[model samples]
Target: MNLNIFRKQNVKTYLGEDIKFSRTLSAFDLIAMGVGAVIGTGIFILPGTVAATTAGPGVSLSFLVAAMICALAGMCYAEFASAIPVAGSAYSYGNIIYGEFTGWLMGWALILEYMLAVATVAAGWSSYFASFIKPFGLSLPKAISGPFDPKNGVYFDLVAVVVVVLIALLLAQGMKSSIKINNFAVILKIAIILIFIFVGLQFIKPSNYKPFLPYHMSGVIKGATTVFFAFLGFDVVSSSAAEVKKPQKNMPLGIIGTLAVAVVLYMGVSIVLTGMVNYTDLNVANPVAFALQYVHQNWVAELLSLGAMVGMATMMLTMIYSSSRLIYAMARDGLLPHHFSKFDKKHNSPQISLFVVTVVIALGSAFFSVNQLTNLVSFGTLFAFTLVSFGILRLRKRTDISNTGFKVPGYPVVPIISGLFCIFMMCQLNKDVFIMAAIWLVIGAIIYLVYGYHHSQLENKNSKAEEA
Candidate 1:
């Protein structure tokens, strides 16, 4: 063991270069991406489930708790994103502040987060798409509409495969074009959400909220942990720092704005949902739509089904984009093959990386069941959040580096709270999640030792300097 894999990146040198990505995204585009990433199955589904199982009518408070925890991490992300303005998000921050091995580990964990997230969301999207089209007397063959399971008589999820590939192609068209689609999906989803809120409000029963803390405050805290996964996508926003204009200014706004918007929407839906239907009766896969159906608003429920598909689609788009950028950043650092970093000059997109990610996601969504592995995604996300939160403390102490952009307020307090909360949430995960995550980390370590360590550009540069 050389034990020399801990060489840190020079932040000044990394940021001083003209990274190949085209800075075409405005603040609005960044915020839209963040919103698109964060507001998927979470708002449409988790409220009712958490309310029923954990906090009853107090799920609204759960959203607030989760949002506060996310904000702590979100502020840390904003600081690093604005200051670094790079593609790898936490991975890059880890490299600059920690070292090569740590960076590689963070990147590997993010790969799990983004890749599995895209697959899981696509699987969920397939169900919604099927349900959305079912009432119209249109349906895919049973065998082709779900994952391959001989016992279940399901062959493959063609809808999931098709949608993943379509989003991948959209991303291959580059950020400018793909963002338009994301923006459209986000607007449609939010409009449908607003429709649900306003329409559902007319049916609110004051009595439904009487037993607000049926499970007590502990349940509310548990509900916060349960719904914490809903806030996962906002971090993907920071992964786009390289492609944003005035990243220093826009990055913080995008990150903080995403959490702000998502929390408000989440709370609104939770309040209306619990008020419209008794919390005990709200536990269903499609809670928002079901709430409407309970109130005899079938038409609006139908509209919400459409919204669910759109919402999940937007999430897949953002996840795929973020995953590709992460790969590009890792490859650029020579942790992987340099070929993966090549961009299409015309479109300014990492077409090769996009293709690879698309294939994996399509295969996972179409052929494999990811329900059990979804918790792994949550664990990976919290792990990244914890590392990013602590990475800021290391970054701020370096006199050689300076960031005039965003800084975490209240100094060490915010990041300390952020990191500690993330760890607390991580502990809340099932034991199996930790086992799987440990296995994943071990595999990453083997790869790093065999390939990443030897191929690293920084290692090579350091060796040359030593020889001189």
Candidate 2:
């Protein structure tokens, strides 16, 4: 075993190089991007489904719990993004503070998070699209509307696959264009949410709150674990640190702002949604729009269904963009082929990585159901969040690192709680999720041993310097 795999990367050397990404993103742009990513299928679909299956009306409290966990992790992430300002997010942070092996695993886990997140959202988007068109008596063929379940009559999710490919094409146009589309989608998404809240408020029966804790506290905790997927996108903002202007100032604001906004929207929608309809009846794919239709607000429901599709498209765009950047960052570190590091100069994007990611996500969306994809995504994200929380504690002890960036408030206590909470959430996930994540990590370790260990750029650089 080459112990070089456990060697830490030099922070100063890593920070000193230009990574070739465009630095055109402002704090507002970063916020828009994060907001665009955070408020999609999680809000549109998960709230009602989680309520019906796990929390009942207690789903609102579940959102709060998930938000607090994310806040703890978000502060840790803010400190890292401000100080490192790199594209790899947790992968780069782990490399500098932990070691090559730990970094590789974090990057591997993030690959699962971003890729499956897009697939899960695409699956949700397909359902909303079906709902949106059905008002005109139009419908997708039964076999093409959902996943490949022979017993259920679903052969392949053609809509999900098509939407994923379209988002990939849009991202290939580059960051600036994608951000513009994200901003527009975010504004429309927010407007639709507000309309749902106010309009749905008038229809609340007040009876839905009776059995709020129908499944008890255990169910609330379970719902928090399940809906944790709603909070996954805030970290994607950290992945954009390399592209932001004055990242030291903007990164923290963007990351924290994203969580703050998303939490409020999630809680408000969860409450109004459960209030307007019985939790048992809210388990359908297009929950938000369905609530309005239940109250005889058909026109509003149709409009909301359209907005949901637009909202999810932005989420897919941000996830795909973030995933490609992670691949680029890992390749730049010699953990993968250097060819993956090449940017399309004309577009200022990683076109090759985008293509590879698009294929994987499209396939996942076409074959897997949303529920299967969602749990796996939550597990991958929690795994990364756990590493980042503890990685910050180690970073604080380094004498060579600068103290100029944002620091997690309350220091050791905050990060400790953050790390423990992530583990607790992981425990709350399905046992099947545990099995799948273990398999994923085992595959990652094999790749590291075969290729990354031999071709490591840092190892080669250090060996050459020693000979001199």
Output the worst ten-in-a-row residue range by lDDT, candidate 2: 459-468
lDDT of 2 by residue, 1-468 (tens): 535678877765455434577898888888888888888756878899999999999999999998888999999999999878878899989998899899999999999989988888899888878877786899988988998898988899999999999889998998898888888888898998888889989999899888889999999988888787678878999998888999889999999999888989999999999999999998897788788888899888777777778788988988999999899888877889988878799998889888888999999899987665567777888888999999888988988777687999998999999999999888877788899899999999999989987877876554554454
**lDDT for each residue of candidate 1 in 1-468, tens digit (9 for 90 to 100):** 557888987664455432678999988888889899889877878999999999999999999999999999999999998778888888888898899899889989999999999998899988888877777899998889888987888999999999999999888888999999889889999999999999989999999998999999999999998898898889999898988999989999999999899999999999999999999998887788788888899999888878888888888999999999998888878889989888788999888888888999999999988999999998888889999999888988988766899999999888999999999999988999999999999999999999988888875554554454
Q: After superposition, how far is residue 44 of candidate 1 from its true place, in Å?
A: 2.0
Q: Taking the candidates one at a time, how many backbone clashes does each contain?
A: 0, 0
In TM-score terms, candidate 2 sits at 0.91
Q: What are the lDDT figures for the candidates, one per model?
A: 0.89, 0.86
Query: Which candidate leads the pack in TM-score?
Result: 1
In Å, residue 283's CA in model 1 sits off its true spot by 2.1
